[model samples]
Target chain A: MPVSAVEVLDARFDAEPDHWPELTARAGLRADWSWPVLAAQAWAARVPQLVTVLHGSEGPTGVVASGFVGPTTRRHRFVGPRRAGGLGGLDVRAPGTSAVPGWWFDTDDGHGGVHRLLAEFLPGIRRELGAGVCAALLRQVPEEALPLLEKRGRLVRKTEPLAHLRAVGDRDAWLATLPRKRRQHLRRLFDTIDDDPTTTVRTGGAVDPTRAAELLRVNLETHRDVPIIPLPQFTGQLTALLARPDVFTIAYTDPRDDTLLALGVLLDHPELPLARHWSALPEDEGGRPGLYFHFYGELMRWLHDTGRPRVSLGKKMVDLKRSMGAEFTDQYAAALPLVGLALLGLP
Target chain B: MKTGIGRDSLRGMVKTGVDALWRTAYRRVVRSAFATVPFYRERWALGGRTEPRLGSGSAEGAVSTEDLVRAAVDLAPLAGGPTGFDPVRGLGGLLPLARPTAGDGLLVALEHPGARPVWDLPRGWRGCLVDAEVDDPALPEVGAALGAGRPVVAVGPDKALDGFTDRVPGGDRVHRVPRRTLDRLDSGPYGVLHDPVLGYLGVLRDCGLWHLDWTRVYARRTRAGLAFTLLRQRSPRLVDALVGGGVPGRVEWCPRHATPVVRTVAG
Candidate 1:
């Protein structure tokens, strides 16, 4: 007789203390966005309806956490909240799996056991979500996991653009990739606004809570007349993330009046690149030229000078990102079944 | 036996016309302010003024345009306060002052049945003519004029007509001019503006309309719609703040061919 065992644990917000280290370690195993504590907090506030967990084998062979919001209806699709930075709904990350789920798996890490566990456990997870589940939308999966997810379900490919520079690569080689005119324009932009000591960039390990709240209030003020739902939610989520040690803040300051021209709150994922929350304020003392452009240049250069490898510009401002030399990469979203294949045929 | 006034009389007439136009515009501004802004509403209430009756006298004598302008200036501090950034707060303060010129244009065009002046139509792929005679003068006051009782037959820009129906309240009568029919009309005022902006203004001009009554138009922009909803829900106090906050004296009209033509018109 062979001994057999499987253990599944439902993780709550407070239980994070026991599971955090393991979750963080597993996050390190692969470039998983959802496993981060900040992602967990975002899900909690924005889409609190879905179940989030730490699923694994008896003594912890694997770990997966997921969330869902909105009623499970036949015609409805699982869409990520409007403000979600990456693919909209149902994100999964396990050891040896890339943030982009469709790529080829790297077999060097002996991920076969975890892969087997995920395959066996996913059906049960589907059953819990209900029968109308369509596809499991995964985004930013590394090149390795693509084939694995395809083997499990139907796959679709899309390109997601990202702006990155290597912490240790040759700067000249990186700059060579940009179009000549664009490269020259970027250089000019830097040169044109490089002067003015009044504009200084400051980077720090953590964000102050009071300052975070103030920043959020000001952001709302700027867009008070515009109507959108996700902004307020994003502000709340950023405020919470500011209190965490893993998050950091970079500010472009106007030394003359102590005004914050632009502030970016970034989350450090030592296993991958840095993710950022960005906001800016126009510098006008009685309707004159402001430091918005100058501050932005200073901040980007500061990040370059520091060892941070890349910056996720996130959503909106696609044209601006292209001007800055960001390349487009594939990002994907999928829906998962509660039971299995039979549900895929639902509308 | 003179169809119009003589030269010496014409100068007097011109001065009177100028003064009348100025006064009418100012009255419209004030009326809109009192109707939309809560601070003005409160001011009127405290001054023992009430609805169904003019501020203290007829529409002309009750509140002078100068008084309305001063009120707007006084209320400028209220913007961004309790009202957040609602445009109504700013516009309400200025409506009493600006409405005379703004409102007169509409009223004169609508009240005169035989005066059919062909203005430039909104440009671009979509364009239509505005027959001023059909408009209802009372529409602004009652907020019920978006319906077909207004006389403008729009030609070309079928989508714009469709958008009007969807966006305007009681917009069942706004009919689209078939492409064949538009080719027959003299292309009114080409090269006036560029792109969607030109196209938009062309529609307004061709329609023979200058100002928009936001109370009747719908806003398609989700953010704008939400802002309007929030403003409506929190009126008066929010209106007061907008007035007191010193919002600029600018009017924001809804985009033409937008789902709702007049999502917001702030003065």
Candidate 2:
């Protein structure tokens, strides 16, 4: 019985309703990430994009930030968002696209006309994209959205467990919410970090592209063997991420040499601040024992003290995340329009 | 009217005669086009269309920068539309066409990735100066250029750079394509097309072309005569089948384009 028009926008920060943070605050939204504005501009400077926003009768509704991604051998396919960068699962959908952290929108855990918005959203982007829809592979979509997609009768969905802490009351209350073992372990971490005169905790600062790049290199080198984003793109993208007023970095540094031991980036939205990316010298720069435990301790403490709701830790490393007393939910992925289609992950 | 007895003079006289003949044919066709179709009529009334200016020494049809730009503006409307304007269609069966003057930039459009390798360009019109679609068999080079974060842009597959940029010669760094690659892309794989308004829209240095999408290319008797359409296929061999005859023609540089999108994030 919803007959209102759904609007598609350019998804830029300066677009309608003017500013992003104010829009989120006004809507009493659940989770909306800030990377789209940052990454879209940075990426647009280098690639072709077909990003769009979904709007209903009330203010802003959903967002789909997509880009042309593929080898020129065939028509480039449009890819959706990813888990590591996005705050995860909004409501908008672009044509032939669904990625981790697929959309960002305002809905009571799936009460909005979100499904209907996607119904109207595809054709618009397809016309703008000037090509056929290959497939929309959305990973880690919210559990709330599953029933809606299931009712449509054409989609492939898989569920995976996602863990994170949704803080309540104070730091003590949050700690109490965790199991005794995790609470004690986390408390011991803070005490050790505090006891170290040589190690100091620094918070409320921006991530430097130079140091951020170095930190990212440390993480990627430890994880895989792929070449990182070249300095220009890396810096441009990092600079955009850093420019957000709500974004801040926390670092464990050696007061002796003034080098970052471990650094974590937190994106502050109305609902929660996500630990978007974090890296450090391996095992505390191959020397320190407490820095790894220290980064998260301070992160949780900061979120609690600042009266924030929670923090999305990240994908994978489940065993470790679980030990920290994080509540876990199953992340569902669905390939849309063309259901049952095997999805190829972004390279 | 002087049958000057010298061989040089005789060559000039033949050239003049051939020029007059081709020009007359060109005018007759275009005139019929404008008078018969509303699309061409409106296009002529507004400005230039690629007439392939005849009145040449070799009777070779060619275009100048002024003419190319003029024609581009003239045919802008037909660039994007599902049906050619007006229902009447023209196969434009075989006609003399002017060779496009090699401008500062050349555009290459084909289905084959690395299609640029098969293209032979005039010295001034090199692939390095082109702003083409993301297709090229020389993808390694394209990928390398992209990886290096060069000034490459991803445009629609249908777009090709016209004699458009003034980015001074020798001012920019370019990865030069060898002549050998263009050699592989040309040869027998060519098909000739003569559009009612744009003249010979297909690539080829000469005429005697075949399999032109005459019905779709010309809209009047064809569709509102307000638009024109030329089809593009993935295989060069398709051109032969579509042409249905063994006549030879070179590749036509298509100028119609959709907006180009640059890839900010690498896959």
lDDT of 1 by residue, A1-347 (tens): 11133232322222334654665555453222223333433332323223233243433433444433334211111122232222223444322122222222112334332344245434444545544443454445434444555554455464344444333334444446667986676556556545657666677744444345345445545644423223222222344456566566777666787665666665555534453545565444311132333334544554566556555554334676565555445454334443345444321
Q: In model 1, what lDDT does residue A111 have?
A: 38
- Restricting to chain A, the TM-score for each candidate equals 0.62, 0.72
True contacts kept of 2: 0.00
Candidate 2 overall Cα lDDT vs. reference? 0.41
What are the candidates' C-alpha RMSDs? 20.2, 20.5
Tens-place lDDT per residue, model 1, B58-91, is 2212332233333332232222223222221222
Model 2, stretches more than 4 Å misplaced?
A1-49, A55-59, A70-100, A104-114, A151-155, A168-184, A223-233, A284-287, A338-347, B1-267
Please give the DockQ score of every candidate, comma-separated: 0.01, 0.01
Give lDDT tens digits, candidate 2, residues B67-143: 22222312222112222121111212221111222234322222223222313333443233233343334444544
Every candidate's lDDT? 0.36, 0.41
TM-score per prediction, in order, is 0.43, 0.45
Model 2 alpha-carbon miss at residue A144, Å: 3.3
CA-based DockQ, model 1: 0.01
